[model samples]
Target: MEPKPATPLLNKETPIIQSKPNKKDFLNHLEAYLAKRDGVDKLLKISRYAAKIVLTSSALPETLTLTHRLMSFESSVGVSRKAFRLGKFVQDVNALRSSHFDSTEDVFLSIVAYGGEGVYFFVEQFVWLVKSGLIDKKHARRLGLMSAWAEFVGYLGSVSLKMRDLNRIKEEEKRVKMSIEVAITRGIKCEEEKERLGKLIEKKLMKRFSVVQDLADALMAVADIRDGKGHFLGPLSVSIAGLLSALISTHKNWVSC
Candidate 1:
């Protein structure tokens, strides 16, 4: 029989004594902690409130002729005007909230769900009206060609869908960063277009507006512990309390206003 080599002490296979916690379990625990502090509820409330405000402000911009016409019809309907408007607003809000919360990136959903979807809905109506000859060719041209409206809606839909998954959001951020880098190196040929894209990237692509800043702060503490830094529960508690304080202050300010 061939002689078997003895295993070196240093190189011997030692089973892992402990494995990392499941990610979903980790998230559930975090969510429970946050829920105790009312963090998750506040995120949902703020998202809906913010969406209502944005939807009203953007749904009837000067460029949307079709939406204006619809509003005119609603007004002419007399007794049903207020009810019609309220019903529509509620419907939009429900749809927006469903889509928004389904996404991992709540911040992006906060803005885009209300603002982007409002615009997209009008664009769809406008294109339909134009194609059906209900809108004059000259008026349609003034508002914007159907092709342009369709393209804009498509862009908004694509972005909204992409926000649903965290991996997709991160991938999109990488792609946007690369495009901007290429633009800088190659030099944008159209100054106007470059400025427009820059603003879109700044305002829509890069911005994250949400009430979860404290949760993120708590996460930093978790990261520090994972990195072998001494654990400090005080920081995490303070972060959670700070968000609650902020919410109270905001409510007071709004009431005063």
Candidate 2:
């Protein structure tokens, strides 16, 4: 046999490793981290708080409606009228906290044991209501029809099923988050997930939100002008609605949530 060719002392290597960001992998890792931080486990306490606040506020909006309907019912006896009107609504408000207890999220169970900041809750009340099939499916379907983001989450895994269906929720949540990030980077326009074999989890589960789509559009504009995440340029038409809004809203809710 001919003598083996002499091997080069050093292997030729490419600097492609440093070429550009592997956004896919980078984002995957980021998603995993955010999921952990935003998880049912780490944020159960926050989730319950968020659930309570949202539930109460949502019901609070119906005060006038409750008063009108009750007067029509003629059950205004011994009812302080205003207080009575608000009382029933208050009870309904409590349902917000009561609904979130003993829930779960895919691999984890909620910390809330029964309608509170307990040890068995994970998802929120509205989500729980949706999960327990206690809400109006038709209304939810209507909400879904408002936008594609709304549709996928309607009458299905939404907040309603997210309690018992943990894995599906996480996968869906991640996809929406990523897509929102995409919209944020795309020429200043608003924007807009899944899974089977863990691989498919990235496809079938995520459901984008209309609110997020609007935010992404704004973020994209910001990035375009500044060439970065939070920078800005020109007259900066940005307001308390886009990234600023998301930041403020999440900040307010997160602290309280």
Candidate 3:
């Protein structure tokens, strides 16, 4: 028999070159972001507050015109954002309808929060109309005051609910930690359980961040209800609070996107 031919050497595997994201990909991402009501609203909120922050800054007299333009832009964006929120509170109402709460207090808080938010959003439409000149400006102040009070009530309920939930999460975390410690002490191989507990802890930590967001929003609501009159909530202070709240909301929307 003829000697077997030597096997040919195999070619090295080719490296996969990932093409950089192009303008088309960027446009796709932009479309996705703009498609989301919350995403667009949050972006507008950030722009509005950022403009307000700049407008409130001490600047040369020559820059006054620019600041005035920024103020107009901020106001316009604010009204536009309200349009995005036209039916937003319906989400909360639906959540209340679908959710199963642990206690009567939870139920009550959810109802109050969702109900108040629903009212606020409904009233906000008229306020937006007034500001946009579609409705009489005489109704602006009344609608604004109503919306503010409704928002304040909603925030109060939301803050209370988040605090309660956070407390419960803390207790659960302690129990999980204790269980983990016991397992480790007993030389038990509970890798899966430990991993599960770790994931649970991470989720709880995210909820904590949500609590911070709600608190920031609550502060802004307080400023609105107070009409930004107090020293602690003057124009600059309100702008800063709004910026903080807008940043938090934008982060949340970005992550969700």
Candidate 4:
């Protein structure tokens, strides 16, 4: 018999969602992931059989403030696994816990819908609505936007970043710029789509003498702002938003493919 062909199981498409060795110590982190999706019971069932993981206990405190935060982050839907990995949602509870609350969620949502995304950031604006001196810590959870939308947006953000990164290292010439533009304009869903976008952009912008990586960077920031909102416990409005201000002119330096 011919030797069996090697498996492609190690391919990058398959990301290993590892369970922390001490999950109990990181229940907050697990909760952040779980609260972002719909159907907890099903996810629980899935986790049970995925490489020696333990089911989470439901005995967490139910403060109304945090409850509201979780509700805000969660949607009535979930993202499909079939969707591409946007950015890797590293469940870094430590980052969240330790990162001083210097910024608001506005920094994440201004590019998409400004009002709701912005309002979520500034707690000072809501001081009158609360009793007194009660800071809400429930802002860490998030739910998807209408089934798989969260994952899709995340994938888009990550891909956009990759394209911007690729664009910075090329020269301004017909063919050279063409190739770089081609590689940078690819879609966010998968490798095939990214490659396809790259080719199309190259064909269109081959003669482009000027390119603005800053504008491209700003455009990428748009996705981060929009999708970052979904990472919150619920959909929110932001305050004090920043401009996606990138001034790209015809005279700027562009790359050649």
Cα lDDT computed for each candidate against the true fold: 0.42, 0.34, 0.74, 0.31
Runs with alpha carbons beyond 4 Å of true place in candidate 1: 1-92, 99-105, 145-164, 168-257
Relative to the true structure, candidate 4 reaches a TM of 0.17
Candidate number that wins on lDDT, 2 or 4: 2
* Deviation of model 3 at 94, angstroms: 0.6
CA shift of 91, model 2, Å: 11
Give one digit per residue, the lDDT tens place, for model 3 in 1-257.
99765432211331212223235566677788789888888888889988877777665353568867877798889889888877777787788799788889888998888888888888988887887799999988788889988888887888788788778878876776666556655667656655655666665776777777767776777777787777667767777777787777776665555
Error of 4 at 31 (Å): 30
Clashes within 3 Å, all models in order: 0, 38, 0, 38
Better of 3 and 4 by lDDT: 3
How does each model score on TM-score? 0.24, 0.16, 0.82, 0.17
TM-score of 2: 0.16
Which is the winner by lDDT between candidate 1 and candidate 2?
Answer: 1
lDDT of 4 by residue, 1-257 (tens): 99766444323663323322333435665565455432243343233222111111223345546544443333211122211122212222232334342235422322222222222222212321221224343422222222123323333433443344345333222344344335444422244433443454553352232223333333333444466444321112111111111112211211110
Q: Cα miss at 251, model 4 (Å)?
A: 40
- In candidate 4, stretches whose alpha carbon ends up further than 4 angstroms from where it belongs are 1-88, 91-147, 171-257
Residues forming the 10-long window of minimal summed lDDT in candidate 4: 237-246
